[model samples]
Target: MAYSYYAYTPSHTAALVFAILFSITNAATVAQWIRYRAWVWLVMVVAGFMESLGYIVRTVSTKNPDKKGLFVAQFCLIVLAPVLMAAACYVIFGRIVYRVVPVESRTTKFLWVPPGFITTIFVTCDIVALLLQLGGAVLVSGTQPTQSNVQQRIQTGKNIALAGLAIQIACFGFFSIIALRFHFISKQFDKRLADKTTDETTEDEKYIMVNETQRKVLKNWRPLLRVINVACILILIRSIYRVCDFALGKSGYLEQHEWPAYVFDAAMMLPTLAIFVYWHPGKYLPYLGFRLPKSRRENL
Candidate 1:
């Protein structure tokens, strides 16, 4: 017989904790975006905002696990929000890659666009899945018995969302590999250029010092890029963890146990916020040359 009601007490509480944290993080990011006029910061803020809403639904489910309607809302919004955040990371990093990589031989000026397109497609699937599951759950709730068939349909819609996440993960892995490879290439190219600069150093000492100083400023970029890259990778890891949660026979941790539920809520949401806090690239965004939409510029 199909199981009825899903959720654990501790897990629900954990979800609320994550909810509050992300809400604060998003609000701060929104403030930063207004000050800086950057689209990427806006994207991150929106994702965190949506995640907070999803967590609110999970908090509701703590009281009534049988409220499958709320359960679907909790799953759909919370689960999909981070992918949007990851996409923001991809765009910001790609733009940096263009600026940081030595121009003479840079091969990927447009690297960010394709990933953006792919993420947009994946999110579209998530939107379709969310509507289907939310609508289906609402339909299931009205029926007296809420037949097994309805449950199965609800689960199927979730699979669609899960499928989108899975594909997005693969996209992330691809981007990670590309980012690492690009870093290595930048290193090699910079090394050769450095050697040439050293050899060409003139008897006139002032010119060499200027070039060396510029080199130091460029080198400072590596550490910051690494921090941003790691943050993005952390989100990818959380997505993998989520795939394990949903992809496994639709294992509702809410149905089988509480620990997995808490693990997911606390482990997954915390790092993204931490990353956003650490890399707060609000200052460097002037390099993007992105004009704020008229409304945003006017707001400031």
Candidate 2:
């Protein structure tokens, strides 16, 4: 006997709707990237593309629910796409640190990792998680329902996927702590700057003047950090939902009910993309060839 690819019949309407939604956001992000040329956002653009493609594949899967290939394609795309979004988040935070924090204060070093290395560290971890989840998804989707070892294979696959999800959760949790720490430190720095009334300015105070100048061209770093924090929380929530999903197995309540997947995964991820588009880093971060006024440059 063939395995049922889905616990419930996939809904074409729902899939199509999301496909269109993601596509729109993807296009908007692409335009934002082009307009601002913020290359760091490239990962986010890829995530949006994968999201649209995932939903598109899901829409197709509704027509042939028994096709394992279609099932695996949609599953892998949907599951791994968020990893890219997570990677983008890591990069965004790093960029924010570089742009907002004064290098003269040496607070950048206090981040436990340098701003430049933040993307390298977290995104590398995210890749490991992505690969693990991809391998597990393929393994689980490859199994035949009638095979004697089917349950064992499914169990093994779920274990691997769970391991990936666990890593994601840990990474997100640590990343959140780091972000919170940075937020507090930044607040303190801002407060100290405000309290000082000397004509003689500290290097950190000079950096704030430059930041204010940049703010005229780019979105304010403070609000951008808040946007990033919200996006991070959304991704964490989705990751937790995925952990429960794979742990519960195919017959699990979340698996059996399609609504939860939409509510927790699809609905949650849509805003993750949409929020970025609204407060696009490209609009906020200084891009290549962007120059500060000669007066501001001379001040530094």
Per TM-score, the best of the predicted structures is 2
Report the lDDT tens digits of candidate 1 across residue range 13-32.
57678778777777777776
After aligning candidate 2 to the native by TM-score, how far in Å is the CA of 71 from where it should be?
Answer: 0.6
Query: lDDT value for candidate 2?
Result: 0.79
lDDT score, residue 142, model 2?
A: 69
Q: What TM-score fits each model? A: 0.69, 0.86
Clashing pairs for model 1 are none
lDDT per residue as tens, model 2, 1-55: 5446887877899999999999998999899888877776788889999999999
Compared with the true structure, model 2 gives a TM-score of: 0.86
- The local lDDT score (0 to 100) that residue 293 gets in candidate 1 is 29
